[model samples]
Structure formats: C-alpha cells, structure tokens
Target: MIADAATRAVAADLERQSAHWVAAATTFLDAEEFASEAAWRSVETFVGLPLRRHLKVIVEELIDIGRATIALTRAARRDALALPEAMAAVQKLRRRYTQVETTLDFFGDAVSSRTSPQLRAALQALDALAGASIAPVLTRAGLAPIPVLTYVDKGMGASILRADIRLWAPGSINPVAAIKIVRHNLYRPTSLFHEAGHQVAAVTGWVPSLQESLGRSLAGDAELRAMWLPWASEIAADVFAFAHTGYASVTALFDVVGDARTLLRWPIGDPHPVGWLRTLLGCAMCRAAFGAGPWDDLEAAVVTGFPLRRADPTVRALLERSRSRMPGIAVACLTAPVPGLGGSPIGAAVDPARVSPAALAELDRTAGAALWTSPHWRRTEGIRIVALAGLREAEQPDKASAWIARAREWMTATPLAA
Candidate 1:
C-alpha cells in the first residue's frame, strides 16, 4: 500500500511538470510575433503568400507538439504501467521539442538582425530581386512558391539551406530557402545566384536528370562518369551563375577565391573541379552565350598560376579532356528544356541578357549623385547588380565604403511593393 502511494505521488509530479511545459509552449505560440494579425499580414505582404503559409504550418506543428505533451501526461496518469513506459515517451517528446526550438532559433536570428537599417535594407533588396528576377525563373522551372530569405552571417563564405531539410519535414508547404551571406562582402553576392541554382536543382529534380543525362552520354566510360558525377551539382550551379551574370560572375568568383594556388593540387573525386577549370567552364559558357572574343584571354589569365608546362600530367590530361566536353555539357544542362515548362529552359526564361554591363556601369558611376533623380535607374537596378558594377570601379576601400553607404541609402528609401 505504501509503494502504491509512492507511485501515485511520482505520477502527480510528472503531470505537473508536463502541464507547466504545455503552458509555456502555449504562451510562446501566442506571442504577438507569430500570432498577431498585424504580424501575419505584414509577413504576407513583405515575405510572400508562400512564406505566410509556411509560417502557419510551423506554428501549427509547434502547437501540436505542446498538445501531444499534455495528452501523453494524461495517458500516463490513466495507465498504471506508465512509470516504466513514461521515460521512452518523454524522450521522444524531448526530441520533438529540440527540432522546433532549432527552427525558432534560426528564425529569431534572422528577425534580430532586421533591427539594423543597413541589414534590413540589404535583405529587402534581396527580396525585391527574388520577386522581380529569381522567382520568375524558378516558377518557369516548375517550382513555384520557393520562398528565399536573406540573413547575415559571421563567415565570409556564403551558404544556402533548404528549410525542409532543416526542419526534417519533406515536401512541406512554402518550403524555405535560406541564403546566409557575409555582411560586408555585399559586392559579390552573385554567390546568391549560385546558391539559388543549388535550390533549383533540389526543387526541380534537375540534379538527377543531369546525372541520368551524364550516364547516357558517358555510358561506356565508367571511370569518367565516376569522376564527373560527383562534380555535377557544382558544375550546374556554376553554369547557372554564368547564365545570369555573364562574365561578371566569372570575375566575381575569381575575386572570392583570391588566388590560384588552391587549384593546382585538386584531385579527382572532389565535389568541385579545380578552380582554374571552373573559371574555364565559365569562360566557355560566356563564349557560348556571347561569341568567342577576349574569353580566351580571360581563360589564359585564369591558368597563369598552373601553366600546362608545370602541371602534373594527370591534371593536365584531365583538363585537356574536360576543356572540350564540360563546357558543352554545362551549356546543355542550362539550355535544355525543363520537362514541363513549355519547351523552355529555366535559363532562357530568366533571359539574363537583361543584366547589361554598360547599364550597370552607368548605374554605379551615377550612384549616390543621380540614382534617385532618375526613376528609370531606380526601377531597374538591384543591390547585387549595382554592387557588382560599383565594386568594379570602386575597388579601393574608401571608395567601396562610400558606395556601400549610397547603396544603403538607395535600398532604405525604396519600399518593396505589397
């Protein structure tokens, strides 16, 4: 009779703790940030319809977890055997809590940084670019409502993540695409295009399609397929970037890596090809897009550090072969019609010829002085476009700093349309 009393007391304490947590979770869910009408409308207006739905799904999942916790506690009380079984169920609930917490933490970080005007303006610019430029391309590729959010990070390296993977819920509504970038390196955020290309592959199943294409193309050559298969995604991304930015992407990539010493020693089986080869692929795409001229000069400059005379024979032979085929393969991947998109390639739908070099240069030259005066320029140029061109002319630190200031001013004043 004493032992039975002890078990009941323990069960009561367990129920109390679970109840407290349920209240806490409910309070969090009810906070104005997620639950307020203003918050929902603002998110829908600025973030998009897709993301509003995504946020609702996340909130529902979190609330459901809380309700499940309460239900589990009641079940424990009703069943006498629950004391032993309770630990396993509690452990499972704890894991679910952890998953929800991680997602919220990431969202919190993005929200916190928006308090800075410069950061907020930058994010708005990215969103504007997404709606105006990137979204249409993705929609043509047949993956509508792929919402992208831009956030600042400590690392110099820019990164992208599919929120579906982050949340461990595949095929979730309004799937999130996160682009984390270095705050100061605003000039070459063409990495945004590269990362978006990664998303395109993920969302549209382009990577598998490319893999199958490669398998068919190289059917008899198993060794070549093994080497090429691992590098396919990276190649696709590079091609995609090249398609958008043209030669500007090539120069931006070189600036990001800074030197060619890293390229000389790259071996087979790596995820990325040698840096020189990457630049060469970009050069090839540029040539294909805009007929051959000066690209040969650019390619020669890219290989200056590891000249053919000094290359390891294996590296040299691999380059000689990839030089001929990789370009064609990349161009085909970019230009080939996406299956359901009315016989249009995602690249053609993007019509990146619109990103003109002369216009961008003019926009950079007139930046702070005349940008707001001319409504035509204001409507056309985006942060990534003008920044890339601005950095070309304002390579000096002081000049770049001034340009960034102007960019902030331009971005802050321009309101994104609802």
Candidate 2:
C-alpha cells in the first residue's frame, strides 16, 4: 500500500503537468486538419491520439498486448536511461521483448492468465497517459513525423537512428513527431520524451556538428554505430527535452526505466555516454527545470543521483534560438546525399540489426508508404537489410552503389544467409 501510495504521489505532479497535453494535442490536430501534405501526415501521426485520448489508447493497447506491467518497464527504462550504451539497451530490450513475447505467446494459448478488465483498463490508461505526456512536447518542439520513420528490421529489432526523416517526403523538414514515436515505441514506450528529444534533435539538426563529428571520430575508432550516438544523443536529448517539456521527463524516466545494466555501464560499452552519467544528466535536467519537486525531494533525488549540472543560460538560449533551424538542416542533409563509407556521426551510429525493431516499425510507420526498399540488400547471412539504408546514408551513395559493394563483400568473404 505504501509503495503504491508513494508511486501515485510521485506520479501526481507528473500527471498534472501532462493533463493539458491531450487537450493541446486536440487543438493542434484540429488546426492541422488543413495542414500541407507533410503537415497532414504529421497530423495523421498525431491523429492517433490527443494527449488525453492517446494516453487512453496506448494504455488500452498495452493491456491488449499484455505489456501492462509498468513496474519493470519503468524500472528498466530509468536504469537504462542513465546507461549510455544504446546497443546495451537495445540488446537488453530485445531480451525483454523476446521474453515477453514468448511468455505472452504461451499465456496467449492459456486462458487462465487473463486479468480482470478493470486491471487491463487501468494499465492501458496509464500507458496512454505516459504516451500522451510525451508526443505534444515533441510536436511543439518542431519534430515532424515521417510516415515510415527510421525502421531497419535486423531481427533483434530494427537498428536505426535515434530518429530519422523521410527525405523523400514532399517538403516536411525536421519531422520530430515521426522521430518521437519511433523513439518512444522502438526502445521503451515509457520514456517517450527522452527519446523524442533525441529524435527531435537529430531530426531538427540541433547538434548536427556533434553528430557528424562523433560519427567521423568514432567510425575510425569503433566497429559499431551504437558506440557513441546513444550517449551523445542522450545528453543532447536531455537538453532539448528539458528545454521543451520541463522536469516531468525525469519522472517519466523514473517511471519507465530502472537499474542500470552491468554491460551497459562498462567503460567498453559502445554507446559512449556511460550509464551513470546519462542518468545523472537526466536527473540534472529535471532538477534545473522545475526547481525541485515537492519538499525538494525530487530535486534532491536528481542532484544526488545524477550529480550532473545544467548548461549555462547563454548556451541554453543558443539552443533555444537554434531550434527553428532543424527542419532546414534535415532538409539539406537528406536532399544532398551523404558520403558513403563515412558521413554523419549520427548516421555512422546506426546499426539496424542492433536497433530495437519497435523503433524500426515506427520508422516504417513514419515513412508513410514510401518505404525505402532496397531489394538486393534484403537480409542474407549477418548482413542486415535495414542497416544497409544507414550504411547507404552514411556512405552517401546511390542505393545500388551502397548495397552492391556490401553484397559483393559478403559474397566474396562472408555469405551465409542462415
């Protein structure tokens, strides 16, 4: 009872803050009814739910899907949020998703595991609430939605960018909304805001230099894309997330993920930001945003846990001012083909096989029918189809040029499909 009470108490303020999200979403959607093609799709993505309705829907969907248990998901999310190794989280979530899928598949066959409708309903509602809380913030931040966002189905899940855009789209620049959904569902559905922030940053081009630089620096030094993008993106996301949505993101963090992973925090972990540091940044952002919560308890928790500090006001202002430039950057980046072999650090960090499939699905969904399909690159042996796209984008070549080389390499040296 006490635990439940404490949980609810903590959730109260977070809930209150998110209350208007749905209504705001509704207003935005209504206004977006006449949005341009890209805007229409953005609205369509937002069409699925307003802050309130979306939360309700997500809550219901999670229940229907039997992923209603928030305790562990939240714990895992919080724990992993701080863990900077994106691949570790991807690996961990894959294990969890697989375990859940298998267990649910079994339980699906056995009717005895069914819970009461009330419990199911409540679970769904909570999920919707969480989802509801994050989307609007992302939208307002100017992240547009791509119909089939950044999906790369490598089986473990889709390895993908923190969020990606539909360069092929007519004129939608910085589809932050599309990226947010991909981020939210692809990994953990709970920390929608944190992921959305990264999606927005990447989609918006807030830290393109950093992303590109990291990609270049790390590519030469590392074998995997997850080595740095996750950590760097996490910090960048934390900055923008706090800037756009305030401190509830931390609560969302706590509510979603829990304890850090052993492998994730290891200095050797690929996603650069160490787990402890990422979590600390998350908490620090929260501390700065709301000036500490009730009795300064939340503030104390963040300060004690993260031990991270906030960006100076001038820096904050610069980011805020620069927020509007994302769409332009995204448009420019996508229109001009990136170089092959090496390009953006952000692109360099993508490993579709290693990314969460849920994320890829979001990307797929965001891509909105114009799914970038490369036939020859289809999964064969260890070579992933989705990853080919990132490699293509990273290498900056015509689709054929990108895959032909990879295919040739595979056939000559490592061609085992099964």
Candidate 3:
C-alpha cells in the first residue's frame, strides 16, 4: 500500500511538471513574450513573409515537443511506471525545455531589434546589402541564396550564424543567415560582405578548396604552406569582400585590424591571419586587380608604423619572409578555380575591377548627385554606392561626415524584400 501511494505521488508530480513546461514552451509560440503586436508588425514588414513563416515553423516545432512530452507522461502513468520511468521522462522533457528556451532567446534577440524604428530601418538596409553582396556568387554557382537578417550589437567585428545549420533545439535547423553588424560601422559596412563571405564559403565549399589551393601554391616553402593553410577560411572571406568591394573592403579591414601592438600577436590555431600580414595581403589584392593606387600608400604607412624590429625574432623572421610573398597569396585567392564555384574563379563571379577606384569614380561622375537621391538607383546600386562612400571617406577624410550621411540615408531608404 505504501509503494502504491508512492507511485500515485510520482504520477501527480510528473503531471504537474509536464503542465509547467508546456505552458513555458507555449509562451513564446506566439512571440507575444518577446514583442508587442505593433513591434511584431514592424518586424513582419521588414523581414517579409518567408522569414516570418520560418520563425513560426520553429515555434510550432517547439510546441509539438511539449505535446509529445505530455503524451509520454500520460503513457507512463497508464503503465504504472511513474516512479522511475515517468520521472526519467519528465527529466528528459526538462532538458528539451531548456534547449527550446535557448533557441527562443537566440531568435528573440533578433526579433526584438526590429521593434525600434531607427534600428529597424538600419537592419532592413543591411539585409539588402547582405543579399546584394552574396546573391550573384550563389546564383552564378547554381545555389539558392537564403534569407539574411542583420541586427546591431556591440562589437568591433561582425559575425554570422549561418542558415540551415543545426540549432540548439535537437532537430531544428536555423532558417536564416543572421548577421550581427557592429553599431559603429553600420554606415561603412564592408564587414557585412566579409561575414556574408563566410556563409558563401560554407555553402559553396570555397574554404576547403582554397585551403587545398594554398597548400599547392605555397608548397615550395614548407613554413609558409603550414602557416597559410590554417588561414584559408578567413583568407577566402577576405578575398570575397575584396572581390566585391575593392579597396573599400581593404581600408575597412585596416580600420578594424591595424593596431600596431597586436599586429604580430598571433595565437596558436587562430583562423585569422596575423593582422599585419592580413592588411598587407589586402594591399596586394588591390595592386593585383587595379595596379598602383592608394593601397600602395596605405601599405607603406602600415609597414612604416609597425616595423619588423618590434616583433619577436621568430615572428620578425616569419613576417619578413611572408612580406615578399603577400602578392602571391592574393593571386592564389583570386585566380584559383573552386569546385563550389563550378570551375569559375571567385573574381569571375564577383569581379573586383567593377569596383576599382576608376570604376567607382566613373559611377559617381555618371550618376551625379542623383546617386544619393534617386529611389531607383538607390534600390539597384545601393551596395556600390556604399563602396564609393567608403572609398571617398578613406580618400577625403575631411568630407567623411557627408559621405557617411549619404550612405546612411540610402541604407535606411532601401526596402526589405517581401
């Protein structure tokens, strides 16, 4: 009789715990906990129907897990196995509940960012830029581009949580490429292309191919090959950005990674190239594509500021050897044909020459003042205008404020896709 009474108590406890988690999962199923209806409407307006449906699908899946947990609890009770079996079932449900909460929190932050009008507009524009930067390469490579979501966060560098990857929820796949753009660099966001490059590299297998190519290209120097092989992913992304945005991407990269003290501070197994080497590689890319430009001056400035004497003897030797080979590395990145790109070089898909100093100047001269004000041009060529603005800001620091204002205006004006 005592054992029977204990079984009844365990069944009741399972029932109560199941009810609590079901309610918890259901709370975010409608997203009301994360945003008000008006705010949600604003998100819907900017993110479009497909992304909204994806979010809904994720939520519904969470709720369905809750339902299944409840069914398991009831079945345990019916089988009179409440003490051990039902208790284990409820514990498993708790673990799943935690995962569901984590998934909601990850997406909820994105949804919450859309509530504020200023941020909403900025993110919407970033979404367009991200799409513009990545679509041509993906389409040319015969892969479909996924939806992109941009949100502002406090950081020096931007990052991406790529779509279709497994999420915290056991069976759930991320439905969008969520790119976090740093607040300070929103107006001159060449980093967006870098993060998008990561997504492109992942989907198209550019990184592994580039890694193999780098191995072959640097085979003559065992040390150089070993050092560069590890940096293929980052180098691939940098190549992607430089291919699409030219010197603007290079200059923006300099802005982010140019501190002299940290220039040679490479941690073991870090995917990023040593900062000084990375910036020089950017200059090499410009030299290769456009020939004799501001990047040469920039490279001189970086080399002068961060001399090899400051580095440790071992590091200095590596830097000295790598300096002469930077141009070759850039060429390898640009000219190599990748299987992911269907035997086409990255440069062929998104040509750097299109955004060269001369080309950007020509675009500006042809568009005149209408480049900033025309709705049609802003919609179609907004990404190139951003590159132009970055170039102008780098070339004419005195007029940076005006260039930034114009870039911000168009970015806010551009519409998100439906």
lDDT of 2: 0.33
Off by over 4 Å in 2: 1-190, 209-230, 255-257, 260-264, 294-418
**For candidate 3, lDDT tens digit of each residue in 29-109?**
677676556555654333445656665676677667667767766666566643566677678778877877787677677
Better of 2 and 3 by lDDT: 3
| True-vs-predicted CA distance for residue 104, candidate 2, Å | 22
- Please state the error at residue 128 of candidate 2 in Å: 10
| Candidate 2 steric clashes | 65
Candidate 1 ranges with C-alpha deviation above 4 Å:
1-3, 30-60, 74-79, 138-143, 163-166, 169-174, 212-222, 258-261, 265-270, 292-297, 307-316, 324-330, 356-376, 381-384, 387-409, 416-418
lDDT string for model 1 (360-407, tens) is 455557675555435455566553354354435333545756655665
lDDT score of residue 124 within candidate 1: 59
Write down the worst ten-residue block by lDDT for model 2: 150-159
Question: In model 1, which range of ten residues has the least summed lDDT?
Answer: 35-44
Candidate 3 regions exceeding 4 Å error are 1-3, 42-48, 74-80, 414-418
Say which prediction, candidate 1 or candidate 2, comes out ahead on lDDT. Answer: 1
Angstrom error at residue 37, model 1:
13
lDDT of 1 at 400: 59
Candidate 2 matches the true fold with a TM-score of 0.29
